[model samples]
Target: MHIAPLSPDDPSELGGYELLGRIGQGGMGQVYLGESPGGEPAAVKVIKPSIVDSETRLRFAQEVEILKTIWGARIAALLDADPEADPPWLATEYVEGLDLSRHVASHGPLDALLTASLGATLAEALATVHKQGLLHRDLKPANVLLGPNGPKVIDFGLAVFAESSVSLTAANTVVGTPSCMPPEQANGEKPLTPAVDVYALGAVLLFASTGHAPYRADNIHLLFHQVVDASIAPDLSGAPEELVPLLTAMLAHRPQDRPALDDVIRRCRALIEARGLKVAQARRRLTNFTAAPAHVLDDLLAVDRPATPGSTARARAGAADVPPGQGESEPEMLAPEAAQQEPGGFRPDRQEPEPPHTPPMPPAPVPRPTDPRLLFARIDTPTPPPAGTTTDEAAVKPDRSRPSARPAPRGGTGTGGGSSAPRRSLRHSAQARITAQRLREAYAANSPF
Candidate 1:
């Protein structure tokens, strides 16, 4: 919700739109608050040049085509786009409000009526996407904007052509946040169906109702396993009793077990009707509930420009009440290799303020070696003499007397290569023993023995 001032490196203009500031940093690009020539406010999302490869361009173009087909009140409409631009950029109606994730984090969880109304509107929006043969592969709470009008689902960066002919990302490349990922996605299933989004929406609604995802883990790898394992049921302890049954169906492990979008909308409507309110009345209630804080922003950006349709002026104001340093945490991106094996990692309910600029990807986790000898052998350290063996029996000194022979070829062993192999083996064995002893001592304090 915070609108950070544009940095020196950020372009002041893109595709003729005047860039105001940054709305938020995403995996593929930076979203800027921009003003069109006609004075209409737009959310301009430009692909980072560093990431603009041929495949990425193709994907962006496909997304543009998909967006062209999508039109819904609950979804942000695509305003303009230039897929052939230097880095390629697209603009959508800027929904000025807080993301559901940060809103729930700063304020407490929403009541049942509000949660049900949000779920129904979002489900209808997704239904439109599915009707066009598109799937919003990433549907977390952060992607839903609590705008002045109502909840509008934004960020289609991870959307995919759900039909048989197209695949946007590479094979086995895992995308989407860990906490909200469906079992099929977590297990690397291809040609995903609309049910994946249904499962994610369940996670989003759960967070809206209870302030946490169904699953939690110490690291991304463990979270992936929890999501994929059928034996592990989601922890639904804190969910509202009325909503638990619907959340359970939507969060089902198997795609077939989950309800279709229409069914989901039906159930959500039923919940609202039970509260003695029509769907429209409940939606207005939701709009009023979330829009209360946005009024404060009328003065903050008053001088920028008069409000237009879906202006970004209200975003910073709606989020103004969130205490400094209490914003939602940035999602963890799982590398391709990690995706196939461990899937991904995530933090639940933690707050990390968004950096003013996009941050570089963090280094991958270090692989733990199973064999100490293999680890020690890779390093060029000298091998010590073995226990109970004197230097005369074990030490092999390279002769400094002779002119040092030309360094060995890439894979060739040097002079005395055969002898060196045996010495190296002995050294590795000795080092392995020492490492084992040290490790045992270091862990002895916690050992049952």
Candidate 2:
């Protein structure tokens, strides 16, 4: 939502690369999209001149040293850096595709399989860093890039070591954002440990699967109190059921109670596979599929199910037809003939004709459901929390980041003596299944990086 004005620095003066545009800016510096000398896309973060004081200079040098050791780790790799220079810079491998924040907002919560895969990918990356005696202090959505390969963590500007008294703070430095920062950090606890990052990753995952932040507030003061109270339960209505336990483990109030990064990776990967989605390749297989289990959400059950069909062409087109110079030639050539009148039909041409430019067809309307459960059920994986661990909100931690309690199941209980929780009502059909498969193929082959 923030916009920035263009910087007029000469590209050649900085290095032998072309500057594309300014992408973002923060406390550290401005991030510009540029190309490497050899033509690789790169993101260059130029440190602000004011941070050249001895304190900021020393921290930048330390970052360079640590990053050089963990060069090719899962997230993004540092391509170049010059901590000694004025307006110091750290250029990293540029990742294409939307950030996790933008992607979720645009596409709805990702399908359960994709969400689970994201957790595994991140845990794996974090483990790599943790194993190297490094801790990624900033683990929020803006720092996690969603490339075609899956998710990759980036920006180690604020990362610290496993055991180092020299904190990254000096003179009123607020290390991280309030809503996602761990309770210890929010309480001015310096010399932060790895658990801080662990807790942050939990909040980020919650945001990825649900649209809201776990600890949002009007201001940082109240947000810090919420973190201290440990009162928030993530809004997990759309998250896979299997993820509930994993999230619980990650978001444990005490840092000592959180699972190691390795465990996090293993559990997330297991969830994805358990839901019948392949991690390596998610292409369509031998047959089309749908899951209409007996118990269903009231809204979903109310839907007038469309008959199974071999093609969606007879049903409706999804997007507006592109004109001649826009896409393939065939669709344009066929339009006039297809729009022509048939002989003995109830053609409204007899009464009056619509504007020739107007098409006879309207794009299929994708109506959003009122029920959040139905919307999230679009994701196929279930988030099965470990049996009998009460998720009561009132008994939250000293920090009160708990979300509101949802409505009880219909009739103040669920159907057939089953547990009183929402069940994902999957509504895949043959035609839609084929469409999804083709999309997967297109996504796989288009990995430019």
Candidate 3:
């Protein structure tokens, strides 16, 4: 994922954590990279102001509750949250790795062994979630993070308690990616069960092996149709032989037909062991294939070096020499001119200076015209000609300065405002139109549209 610089609108601090930068944005809000007091990196998701209603707040609070109940190495543990805070936010352990979708797009689909490992890891993660009596509800490639340890499931924004009285998703409203959703979910069947996640895991595994979803379509409606169709088989042509049977069973149309999480885990492990590879070895291979380089973490944690005592003294003396209001918040390690020369640039062995505090200015009120008609009035004033030019000269003299009405020549400059060659003959124009029509017909016949 891309880490963007903090924008002016982004808060510098949230619930005692100092926000460093933006990680990404989602439907609910933005996820920012934050650092705790002890310098621990965290991923903080702040809800959007537009969604700060009572229902959304309750859902966010429920998400926090669901996250608190989940605990596993393959799960991103909830660190902190403030549902009551202005624009409620939740923080989770920042997994330093790319999401599974991005990983597959960058590198080709994982091999059989690695895919099996991912399946086992994610299955176990889902098992843990189910143990807490919660349904992930939205488990797809984008939600799974491939890190050093293994596959870690990250987002719980759409999770719900198995026995909760309140429903975050309204009746008959779909809530997940269509291609990865189970048949019942696509059909809006309730009440939902853990089997939905099992079916989604099957889709994820298919994507990991084939680099595309099982139910391929150009739009959501068709994809959802394919998912809900009991007779339509998933396209698993590219999946490994050992994985085909297990994936097929997991993606069964009926929820009861799908294997339990425990069975899924066992099948994945059996596939790995059958290939003369232990689960540990498979995990190491997965890490080697997907983990981010160590240098990336180093760069993320790097800080500016402290300045020398002599430079500090010189900088202080220079600051004292400057007049008040010339340069506010001048550093004690660099002169005002030098600092101004390079705004936000890294200086060797020097720490960056904090900006001086300024009083918040009240917003200026928008001024409304006393007469409403004046706002819609159009000004039609004409420009006065040059002093030497007369009105007749301006009127009679054709403005060669303006472009001609005719189309420009194919290869000649059109600035001279001269007409190009005469138009093509009627016969030739008719032939060109006929050729275009034929091409359009051919395209319409062959195109998916």
Candidate 4:
């Protein structure tokens, strides 16, 4: 927010991607929208060679060389980059939706389902990056892209590895957005484990649900004090009931205290699917309304804004066909039919799948986590799905006959806390809710985020 907007008035050039218009600028650098000779679009980040230094640029160039080896749709595609080029430039896929920070500011806090869906997706993406032996040292709202497929995590310029950097001194140089950063990051500590990303994601979910971070201040020093000492919990009054548990586990102070990315995705996705079922009902009840701007200023109350265009539009249109007054608020307990079910719950995402199921495009997982930290593959790579499990399970029509199993995270690191077990099981969403509730109760006694 401190930086000025990158305007079209300036016509600068970098390598092959001709700078079309300035996108925006921050402390570290300025980004411009550009297009290749093939007319493919790209977001080119242009940073001063002096600010980052020749040695830094070379180090970064090496990262770019490694980035070329990666291929994933969820991640912004890295077309071309030049660290050795004057002022240094990195270009990634030009995603259409606004960045998470801009999206939140313009649209206000995200609805429960949207936030949960995004949380799950981002965790999966992070897992992919970590698996490639690369460390995304900086992860914040600005780096996440909101797309029809879900949230696409962007920016790997700050990526480091066990061999990439010679010193842990990189952390002390001060990178990362302060508010969303974890305690270890804000304190200038080095050799940060994957836990830091978990902590950051938790903080992001908090911001999405509550529209505020764990702490805030004009001065970075003060913010760090609050992050380190105050233990000030976020006010979750605005968060959905089911997501509280996952958020609390993510924001745990100690690195070990936080859940791994895979668990984070599993828990968040379960909550999302549950809320998605209700969105069907919510769509029906949105009577007596007018079209609003793409941006929403008020989202604290879970207001039913009309769905966005594209795939979501079709989904919402179908959902709106449900009759009114069918039900209100989530059930305090499952109905008799739900109780009689196999896992004993309402599982819309699972079942045999009915007709007209809208599926999201599958994105490739991040290539690998390069690194100082031990990167594990089973935790992030896509499993040859179990027998009878189709590659596109999540996209299937609503089916209540079969019980719901937790959706597997498509990308991101798997929980590697040992014993080769996921930090969380893809259990029934309802059971996960029960477990989350207990965790939330414990967190309530201790902290809110």
Worst 10 residues of 1 by lDDT: 415-424
Superposed model 3: Cα runs more than 4 Å off = 163-166, 294-297, 301-449
Go through the candidates in order and give each one's C-alpha lDDT: 0.68, 0.54, 0.68, 0.54
Per residue, candidate 2 scores C-alpha lDDT tens digits across 1-449 of 11122445523234544555566778877777666767676777777886677878888888787778774445687888888887777787776534666545543455455556667667778878888888888788878765534466877877878787577576556677776777777776667677887888888888877756667779877776777886665445665576778877888877888887778777776776776666543211100001111122222123322222212221111112222122111111111111222122111112211223322232233343333333222222112223453323212212223221221222211113322223222233233443355456555555565
Tell how far residue 35 is off in model 2, in angstroms. Answer: 1.4
In the range 37-151, model 1's lDDT, one tens digit per residue, is: 8878899999999999988898899878878888888889999999999979999998876788866765568889889999999999999989888899889998998886899
RMSD of each: 23.5, 22.1, 26.5, 21.2
Q: For every model shown, what is its TM-score relative to the native structure?
A: 0.66, 0.61, 0.66, 0.59
Report the number of clashing residue pairs per model: 2, 20, 0, 20
**What is candidate 2's CA lDDT for residue 58?**
83
* Residues 1-449 of candidate 4: C-alpha lDDT, one tens digit per residue: 11122345544567787665555677767787766777676778877544887666766676687677555656878878877777788888876445667555543566666666667667878888778776676788878765434456777766676234354234357677778787776776667788878888877877876778867789988887878763576445667677788877887777888898888877765665565554323322221010111211112112333211122122222234423322211222211111122132222222212111223333344333322111222122223335575434522322234322222222211111111101112232222333345555555655636
* lDDT at residue 52 of model 4 (Cα atoms): 85
Best by lDDT: 1
CA RMSD (A), model 3: 26.5
Error of 2 at 250 (Å): 1.0
